[model samples]
Target: MANSNGSKAAARDKRQRLTAAAAEVLHRQGVERTTIADIAQLADVPVGNVYYYFKTKDDLVRAALSAHADHLSLKLAHLDRDPDPRARLGALVASWVERRDITARYGCPTGTLAVELDKREPDGIDTEVGQLFRTLVDWVAEQFRRLGQPDPHDLAITFVAANQGMSLLSNALRDPTIMIREGERLRRWLDDLPT
Candidate 1:
């Protein structure tokens, strides 16, 4: 039985809505406090339907993160628009600062998963979060390579750490300024590189 494009689109739309709603719930209430019923209500979908889409709460968490990671990947995957590596690297830094949703009540989904991973056994959710970080780092590294720089992997790791550090600053100060300053430092380093 083949499904029509329209039906598939609608299903995807529903899943996206559900994933977003679940993410919001996890962010606001903390993953430990979030419940499937709460996600269902927030999504305006029936409780049974939530379960139908996701077998368990962990499943919902992974799906939400997958969607979030994919959204970010789509946004910055083109971080190498410029032929110059330095320019591309700068763009990568700027993108993180510009797109960061500082007002997010929930922390980074990947960060949350990382913290949770340490407490619990290895699972799909932990793997998904790891993959997201790796993907982001790889993207950053690609830009560094374009610049003919050394240690692309280390540069990517630094960028990832700096981005996460900004989140902590944003949370503490309730301001996005710290990220701007950090982004400037990143650009300055690229500017100083030997031509």
Candidate 2:
């Protein structure tokens, strides 16, 4: 049992290393140019080791997306305990930008991964990425529900779309200020929503 657990842990570590490599490739060269060899080199594992863990490049891509999304989920989960939905919305947006810069190292990995994979075939990790967006949408919808809105789901989608749109534009412009300004506006609008 101990050996089994140890093997699982080792495999998990290896997977993380590969995912980190994928992120490095995606960041330095853009996803289209980044290749399995690039990731294997970054991870310092034999090129064969990559295939040992991930079936294909798309698999690795999805895993990378899932890793980053999980990180975001961890950051967002605690907001559920916050009493004021308005305050929660503000904090969620603030944390999204702050964490994106800090953890992502390059930028919002979510956006980059989505753009890279959107043109390709769907796979395991794309669902995880889709769910990440759904998470934000649901969070916003929950806020709307708290605010007595009739359609929390649709409202949530708009809120998330606005947030993602802002982030995408901010990344393109290479301006954190855009995210801050637009994020603040979104939060204020949420706060002003009638309860």
Candidate 1, residues 1-195, lDDT tens digits: the string is 256888788777777788999877776676778899999889888888877689999988887787778777776756545677667777767876774564333455566557765576766667777788888888878877766778988978987887787766665676777767877887887798766
Clash pairs, candidate 2, are none
* TM agreement with the true structure for every prediction: 0.83, 0.80
Put down candidate 2 lDDT per residue, 1-195, tens digits, no spaces. 999999999998888999887866775566778889999888888898889999888777776776666776776688877888778878888876664443333455676666666667765455666777776677678777887888889878877777677777776766777777777788778777777
The per-prediction tally of clashing pairs is 1, 0
Worst 10 residues of 2 by lDDT: 99-108
Off by over 4 Å in 2: 1-8, 27-29, 99-107, 121-128
Which regions of candidate 1 are displaced past 4 Å? 1-9, 99-105
Residue 114 lDDT (model 1): 70
